[model samples]
Target chain A: MEVLVTRQINKYFYEPEKFQVLKEINLTVNRGEFLSLVGKSGCGKSTLMYVLSTMDTDYEGQLEIAGQKLTGKKQDELSAFRNEHIGFVFQFHYLLPEFTVLQNVMMPALKQSKYAREDIRDKAMHRLKTLGVEEHAHKPSNKLSGGQQQRVAIARALINDPDIIMCDEPTGNLDTYNTHLVFDIFRQLTSESNQTIITVTHDDEFASKTDRIVQMSDGRVVV
Target chain B: MAGNRFQLTFEIAKVHLLSKPKQTIIAMLGVTFGIAMFIALVGLMTGLNDFTEDITMTSAPDIHIYKDITKPRQSILQQIYPNDMVWVYHQKPKNELTKVRNAKKIIELIRKNELVRGVAPALSSQVFCNYGPVQLNGYILGVDIMEEDKLFGIKSKMKEGRIEELLANREGIIMGKGLAQKLDTKKGDRVVITTPEGYTMTLKIVGIFQMGIGVIDNVRCYANIGTVQTILQQDPSYITDINIKLTDRHLAKKIAAELEAKFDTKAEDWETANATFLTGVIIRNIITYAVSVTLLIVAGFGIYNILNMTIYNKMKDIAILKAMGFAGGDVKSIFMIQSLIIGVIGAMAGLLIGYGLSVLISKTPFNGGDIISLDHFPVNFDLKFYMIGVVFGVITTAVAGYMPSRKASKIDPIEILRGQ
Candidate 1:
């Protein structure tokens, strides 16, 4: 079944002058599918990722994620929807430096408040174990290496069992070894738990390793 | 669910504030210093005001009913002329009795009034105290000793002998400290007194009292009404003044006006008699409030600046939290909670410090020389001033916090994340 669907999505940037960024983009991704969106610089792939993640609402389109229409909802309602259904991993490890690694993973789930605090903590530890970063769980997030911090970010994204995970250059700042580690983790998530993912990346090898690739040039998806 | 959300937000706020311990403490101290100064200044100023008011209240009656010695501006000639203006150049003044007429009946009527606390009848006479070969001119006031004591607290002012001694010895007189010193007479010494009417009497000095006012202490003395009446060669029914103490001193002006119109006597209220002093009290209070509020506002500005800088520094954290599903209101709440925490804790500390400061001030020795008998500074420890200080401090901090927190809440996560 399709976990996310976008119909004729169009976006514009008004600064400097009126400019169309995304042109009638139609996309769909099924459950358990891992897809990569690749494009040249300023080709609107990041903008599309933002629109799909429900963070950028200034667009003209219809977006349905996990069978819920999210195009015209209030900001707080959209935030609640994002909390329950979508997880994000950014290029930089966006862990709160003041919190422990385990606390960083538990932050979103605590905000969701769907589980007891102890259960959330246990689940966060389990996710860190799966990501092979459980040894750093009690350490402050900023104390970890770049690759270890990225793995912790993935653990945080998985703590709430969201329907979809969106990533913006998840390993762009990582070395070759860390990039392969993150790609293998994404592959395992999709195969083992039927997790759906859509990531924007610049690495051709990383895009080729995913199950599907949507190539975009000049704001239009070509393949 | 709301409780849980607030708890989460408060937890985050706690972590944020804890991470910057120095900044938080500095902001809190700003509020603390402001509130402490406000409490201390207002307490001391009001204490001084109350001290002065007490002196005035103790020595002066709420309303004094006496015969006016001033001749009427509208004379019989003006009354007869009706619409015409009549001018009398260098007209000689006519003598009139400076005594309240029907004194007994008026006192009885005033006693029936529910607002009257107590009434004391007195006869005032200009007298010459004879000591050796020198005679000093002064005024001798004749009063009922017990009634005067009850109304003016004369017993507290006595420096040498008891007020009851004047009653025991009908020929006794309570002389002011300065007047007794000038006459070189101590308690138990006989001083011959001659009234302006040339009736002479020898009276024993019974007590030396100090009223803390230079003019009154140097020239005034008190005696039994019968003794003063005999010294003035007057009958027992003669009374020159009636002093009335009221249940509520604020009603003195209205009651004085009413008494003046009804009895055809000059009635003076305490406020009218001490108009300039009352004005000074009001001006001091205004200055106290103005300075206190300004201090609090300055402290609020300090909070504003610090909070604004915190928000600016926390831009990345705010963006990440928003991306992680925290709403704008949640972000706003986190910062507001931090501000209020500082305000409440700071205000509490300020109240304690302010109380300590007030107590220290009250214990500091102060000598007012010969004019006023005060040994230490007066500091009013009124709870209401503390309450006002804390409430104002919190409000000021809340306003200071709101502007920056609102700016924080309006931050767009996409912009910050996109930059990364």
Candidate 2:
């Protein structure tokens, strides 16, 4: 079954004069598929990622995620939907500096409040253990190394057991060893839990390892 | 669900504030100083106002009724001519007695009214005091001693002898402190007083009192009404002034007007008689509120500046939280909760410090120097003023927080994420 779909998507930028950023884009990904979107800089791959994540709503398209149409939803409703169904990881390890690593991982689950606080904590600790960052959980997130913080960010994304995980250059700042570790985690998440993974990456090697690759040039998807 | 949201946001707000303790304390101090000053200034000012009012009310009656001497407007010619405009030049004044007619009957009618607390009929005459070599002119008022005491609490003002001594000795008089000093007479000394009509009488000084007013204490004395009547060679029923104390002094003006029309006498209320003092009180109150509000607004600006800087510093954090599925309202609530916490805590500390300051002021020694017998500074600790202070402080902080929080809420997360 398809986990995400976008039909004839278009986006524009009006600063310093109007310019089309994305044109006539259609994409689909099936459940449990690990998909990579590959393109050079300024090819609108990041813009398409933001639109698919529902964080950027200024676009002309029909977006369906988990069989639910999300094209005309209110911002708050979209936020709630994202909280429950979608998770995000960015190139930068964007953890709150003041919050402890464990607390940072527990934040989204706490906000969702679907489980008791203790259950949320245990789930967060379990995710941290899986990412091999449980020993650093009590320290402030800012105190962690770049590779360690990225792993913690992944742990945070998985705390809510979301249906789809979206990543924008998730290993862009990591070394080869840490990058391989993150790729293996994504592989296990898709194969074991049937969770869909979508990522935008400049690394052709990383794109080749994913289950499917969507290549883009200028603003259109190419074969 | 709402409660849970608030709790999460509040926790985030707490972490933000605690991360920079120094900045939070500085913002809190601004509100603290503003509210504290408001309380102390208003308390001391109103206390002084009440002090002056008390002195005035004690020395003067709420309403004073007497016959006014004036020239007749009609002059007989205008009344007989009716429609004609008659002019009279250098008109002589009409013969009218200064004493209120049927004073006892009028006092009885006034005493029957529910608003009248007490009525004291008095006869006053200008007298010349002769003590050995010195002769000083003064005014002597004769009153029923117990009634006068009940109206003005005269017993509290007596410094030398009891007011009851005047009743025991019909020939006794209670002279003012300054008058007794000028005459070089003690409480038991006898002084000869000659009325304006040249009738002389030797009266013993039974007591000495101070009203804390310079004019009254310098040239006024009190005696029995019969003694004054005998000295003036008047009848037993003669009364020049009727002093009325009311249940509520605010009712004096209306009751005075009614008494003037009913008794054909001139009546003056305390407020009309002391208009300048009342104006001073009003002006002081205006200044108090103006300065207090200005202080609170200045403090509010301090809070606004701090919150704005906090938002600027936390721009990345806000964007991340939004990207993590927190709504714009949650972001707004986080900042708002921070300011409200500061406001409530700061205001509570301010109230405590304000009460301490008022108490310290009230304990400071003050010398009235024969004008008034006060021993310490007066501070009115009115609960109403504190209530106003706290309410104003909270509202000021809330308004200050609102703008910055709204700006934080409207920030587009994609912009920050893309810029990074």
Candidate 3:
């Protein structure tokens, strides 16, 4: 079954005279497929990803996740759904700098779900270990290295066991070592957990490792 | 969800507080100042009021009943009141006690109130006394022979020969020390008490009294109701207007109101009885009210400024709380609580300070004599003023804090994160 699908999606920024950013893009991802969106600057990869992840919904499209229609719901619903059904790993890590690594990873599930107290902590800790950043659990998230922060982001993305994971230039700002470490976590999601991860990256090596790559130019899918 | 809200909110509020300690201190000071103003004004007004009431009681006694005779209403009063409103100043011309109206009936009515300490009918008339052609025309108050000493504080100031002689002899009269000297009459000398009706009644000087009020001291006389009643050729039962003294001075007004509504329904209170005295009280009341309002406004503004600064400083934290799904109402509550606390603390402090100041002012050692005696300045703190001050601060600050905090809450998270 297709875990995610977008048909004829069009997106625009609210201001600046409705400059269209994503135009009539159609895409589908089956269960457990690793999809990579490859593009240069301002080519709508992030815009498309924002729509597909249901974060930015000021768009015209028929989007479905796990067979539930996703349209016209308010911001609060979209936010909760995003927390529960999908996860995001932003380029900057965006791990609330005030919190510890353990707290950061537990944020999505802690906020949106009511699991057992021990289960929540265990799941958060387990994901941190899976990404091999368990030693940094108690440290402030911003103190982590670029590669380590990206790893923590990936761990946070999978902490809720979300079926789909989206990354926006997940390794765009990192050393080569951190870049490879982020990719290694992505590999673990695809092969071991059947997490359908879509990463937008300009790094060709990272793009090549995905099962299929979608290329974009000037706000549309080119090939 | 609530836990998440609290944890996030608690963290944000703490950071907000620590970030601007100076503003917080300023807000606290604002609340304190507001409270202090309320307390001081209330204390001063209440204290002055107490002092005035004390003067009225000490000088005039608890209960005074006079004839409610209709006086000619002046035409000048038509400007302030309707021409139809009858005024009273008819001087039920104090003569011998026996010539007055309903004196015994009024006394009987007064005795019904268990609180009555004494009731004495008073007869007043002007008289010329003869001491070998050096005649002095002075006022005479003919009271009950035995009870004149009990009706007022007159006995306390008796520069006397005797006050009890009214009970023993029909010719006995109590004259003032100054009047006695002026008339050249010593004790046992006879003075002819002349009636306005061209009658002569002789009285032997037996006692003298000196009230501190110079007018009352220099030209007044006291004698038995019988001495004046017999000389006037009127009914013996109809003495002058009845005077009542009560045990509790504080209950005077309540008793006065009750009596006005019951017996002397037409009579005004001594508090409101004399037109000149009433006007003075009304003026003081107006001044006190103006002072109270001004003080409250100052306090209110102080609260307002502090809360405004608090809301201004907590903008970021308010945005965060809103993003965490807190309603605008919650944001308002948080700031309101803080301001309310500040108001309460300041009000309590002001109350203490005002009370202390009132005490200090009371002990102010002018002796209340000399130049002129006004007894002592009494100070009292009324609870209503304290409550009013608290409400003023909390309410004003809360209303003041409301708009700013709401503005903070409505801030867009995306814009705030962008540091706008």
Best-fitting candidate, measured by DockQ? 1
lDDT per residue for candidate 3 within B137-217, as digits (tens), equals 887777765665676666676665656665687788888877887787788888887777777888988877766454565
Worst 10 residues of 1 chain A by lDDT: A153-162
Docking class of 2: medium
Q: Order of candidates by lDDT, top first?
A: 1, 2, 3
For model 2, the superposed segments whose C-alpha errors exceed 4 Å read B70-72, B89-92, B126-137, B181-184, B194-200
Candidates sorted on TM-score, descending: 1, 2, 3
TM-scores across all candidates? 0.96, 0.96, 0.64
Q: Compared to the true structure, candidate 2 yields what TM-score?
A: 0.96
Candidate 3: Cα lDDT at B315: 60
Please, what is the whole-model Cα lDDT of each candidate in the order they appear?
0.92, 0.92, 0.69
lDDT of candidate 1 over B1-420, digit per residue (tens): 667778889999899889999999999998999899999999999999999889878899999999887745566887898789788787666687778999999999999999999999999988999978768988999999899988998999999999999999999999999888888889999988997778888999999999877677888999999998888888999999999999999999999999999998899999999999999999999999999899888989998999999999989889889888999999999999999999998888989998999999999999966676689998999899999999999999999999999999999999999897
Query: How many angstroms is residue A57 displaced in model 2 relative to the true structure, after the best TM-score fit?
Result: 1.7
User: Model 2 over residues B158-182: C-alpha lDDT tens digits?
Assistant: 9999999999999999999988888
Fnat per model, in the order shown: 0.58, 0.56, 0.02
Each candidate's interface RMSD: 0.8, 1.0, 5.4
Candidate 3, superposed: residue stretches over 4 Å from native: A1-223, B1-11, B54-70, B73-99, B109-120, B125-238, B243-266, B274-379, B416-420
